[model samples]
Target: MIPPATPSPSAPKPSRQRQIGGLEFILLMGLLQALQALAVDSMLPALGTMAVDLGARDPNQRQLVVGIFLICSGLGCLLPGTLADRYGRRPVLITCLTSYILCSTACALVTNFDQLLVLRAILGVACAGLMVLPAAIIRDRHEGDAMARLQSTVGIVFMVVPMIAPSVGQAVLLVASWRWIFGVMALLGSLILFWMATRLPETLRPEFKQPIAPRKLAMTMGAIITTRSAAGYVLGMALIQGAMFGYINSSQQLVAEHFGAGARFPLIFAGMAACMACSNFTNSRIVEKFGARRVSHTALLIYIGTSALQFYIASQPNETLWEFVPMMTVNMCLLGFLGSNFTSIALQPFARSAGAAASAQSFIRMVLASCLGSMVGQAFDGTARPLAFALMVAGLGCLVLVLFSEKGRLFRRLLPPGTPRPIA
Candidate 1:
């Protein structure tokens, strides 16, 4: 055709670079993070089946399937950033995805509860790479509220996976055994691994690459701990995540047993998750306008207020699903505002050491959060009391940490020098 005849010398190259640089880049990063959410959420429906089949004696012990995975994921978060910094993002990511595929496959074949837990722990370790690397990648390209906006956008997309993950698990359970869920995880991981190998470039710049020295690692970690904004926000994020996990751990039981939702639990859970997705989408739009600190601080106050109301309502006799669901949905929505913003704020101080900083932040946050979540989950008393109370305490704890990080400031439009403030 005429178009194919002769290309002008002034014509731009087919934008091959732009393909993975803009929307595709955000979508890819979102999918990478969604792998972690999928791993956890998709297994929720199968916990009871797994416990019974695997000979777990206590009902509380079923939570270990989730708790142990989180604990191990936290433990493994320390290494990926160092590896990513040394070798490069692409290689480290591919290796981790391969390990994830293998571990998930192994998890499908475990013969006992202990064996399954061991494999899941290893799988969680693989997932840590997926969790930490995306943040580093985002930091590689953008910073400040722009980074927060991108993170929230990713969260908006990533939240969709969790919203449907339980339903996907339930669908699997309807026709196949729980083991098939892990098989599905393996399949998805394989596909993503292939996509990544083909499309994902080395986002780590040559100048940013560093040798994996023990002294250097220690110094970087010390810097992270010593930085007020990083440390405070990281701790605040940890508490908020811990509180979220508490709800996750107890969700199936609370919905099925307490609310009598039974087979409808997946739909109920999906609705709550959808609230989060909406909130993330909304936060992505507004964070640039209000700044991360102002938006998140305001959301945190609402979260604290919601937690108090939820606790009060949960304590009252004859609490209905209508009331509980709305309250929980609001809480989740508030969390949507907090999670990505908190992460962006925490990681803002370290550009050169983004990988290491992300790893340390993930490690500390996951460990503490998982512990708090496990405690709340173990305290499940066949009522909503434990979850509601834990959330309230977590909200208060997060507030304190945020205050510490902000040095008594709240709702301030803080940004780096030379950054343009958003129009009010």
Candidate 2:
């Protein structure tokens, strides 16, 4: 099979004014992407409530609420790409968003833990479109370092949602039960759906459309698996995300139970998230100057170092919150520098199959990361040791994957012929 042709230097650019303006496009895509984060982070403060109300036998079992959603979301991601390629991005997205809204509402009414888990799984599937489609939309218009810059910009804005979600959840909990969290999610989903329906244009070009054939889909997915850069980066991303999810799954317990920060959980959580957001903003500004690979590689080393320090701190007797929070915050901030760059590199190979490519990437990252994270979370022994060790291990694994992906090269910029390098 022939590889898809790379867009030429002289190729016509899509008009930003024809569809949506640049700033509005970024904001819409950022908010759309943030829904997934909002769903996960906003519920952190309520995990204990959920466990108690749902009659969970083990405190750790509460994590399944987050883990199952990620797993099912990964499962859901497998199909939207093929569907978006065959149909149009707008239709597939709208349908999925509607399903997400309904699922969120259903979650608010579930009476038992099992019932809630089932709904959350379905919600994950519905949200799969939201996670995969927006990136495809960006790919529909941009590529290479330009795409990297836009992705980092979106990350900068998108990080704000996670920064505030815990506070939002806590606020809801102050007046109502945890059920209201889902209700608020539903409302937010509806607003995004409406905004998308009104403003988002069909970004996919007609010539790039693919038919929904089994053989064709298989070949495309196989291509993704066999492509060295894409596969390596995807695996590397999954490992890094595994570390992030470990922190997310255990954050509330770490802050409240381990450090006695129960009343200040939201504030502390928000502060950590703010660190990540600031890092993303910084990356957006500098990625163009230093290139995505260089920036991401540098950040990965820092991440590994920070993780090692965090593990040592967690291993000590009577570790202070001061020691743990700062190290973890720095580790998370490094992640902000890595996520978009890794994704841009992985998606660099696809043109016509952007949706399928995005789907496959999301599927692997979410599913594998969720499993690793769940393991770390369940190993909680009334200390931060498990989480810290898991991160350090994950960081080492991620470095190896990156090495393999780049063929043992690190911090090098390789731009395609005629592709413009980012300027300072």
Candidate 3:
């Protein structure tokens, strides 16, 4: 039976400070988010060279190289959040980053396609930890509006890495071999490890640290599945994420080979990344006025809308590169807007179990996105049309999921602080 009415005097005081220094938290968010994008997109510019070097007979298999890594990454995302719940976020993050660094090095060293695939799988496992811990850390200190603002700040920081990552990969490939990409990743992983070791603190209080025993883990997973509100928003986020994977995986090949842009493909990719960064920055500014749910919901509509237009454009004959690039950039920016806000909404409901919640979210997102991205990559035809079609379909599906999740409208009073009032 429900307990008798508790007096207002008996209610525990709400703590004002929920997280660490704002800038530090933002950087932390950036590094962790960077790993997810870097692990997949960093190798994009080199996919062609990678295929030739590894002597792969099938051209489509090139995308598999990226897809396989993501599959493992998605699988890896499963454990870290819960482990962070049990062991504390710092230790779990360190361990995962260490494992990722080693796996990334292995990616560089692998001589065979099978070996490379296995290494990518291993990298995926390591990435799970890095992917979820930051979200938990954010939850440790803030909720509702405060959480939204902090996350938006982090999103701005997180935005830059993915935008420039492919361009960076392309630039790297000019002076180095494909293996060196892994070497660079090794360096990134090491730096992130060192940074965490020195700067990161344990955010889950002693009273909150749960044991990693199988029973407890199972219980936590069950609770998450039962949390309908949390589940709905993340599903929407996952679809949006899958769309990104579809584009990044196919972009370099589509531009360099299909469009004959050659070395200029990096520049084209950079242009898109720049636009995404701008979108993230814009979200941070307007999130307070428009609210995360309203912004994200509207952005998803735009995201899908832009993709629909792009699809129609793709079907037309003799479309110039100039025609396609503008629309694609717009589509990715739409993604940037939705990415952070949707995630913030997903994480809003579970302040106490941020670590496990973050992990579950990451696992679902990465797994779904990886599978979809891989399929899109394998489906790539000589023209840009297939990529456009995949994006449109993903965008449309994401919209449906969001609508169903929210029951055909947006949520009211989305959280952490400085969260703008809801628009709809």
User: Candidate 3: where are CA atoms >4 Å away?
Assistant: 1-29, 141-149, 199-201, 213-232, 344-355, 408-424
Candidate 2 clashing pairs, residues 3+ apart or interchain: none
Models sorted by lDDT, best on top: 1, 2, 3
Candidate 2, run of 10 with poorest lDDT: 1-10
For residue 48, give model 2's deviation from the true position in Å: 0.4
Best prediction by lDDT: 1
- Candidate 2 vs. true structure, TM-score: 0.86
TM-score of 1: 0.87
List CA RMSD, all candidates. 5.4, 5.8, 7.2
Instruction: Write down the TM-score of every candidate.
Output: 0.87, 0.86, 0.82
- How far does residue 71 in candidate 3 sit from its true spot (Å)? 1.9
Total backbone collisions, model 1: 0
Q: Candidate 1: which stretches are off by over 4 Å?
A: 1-26, 137-153, 201-208, 348-355, 415-424
* Model 2 vs truth, CA RMSD: 5.8
Better of 1 and 3 by TM-score: 1
Report the C-alpha displacement of residue 409, candidate 2, in angstroms: 3.8
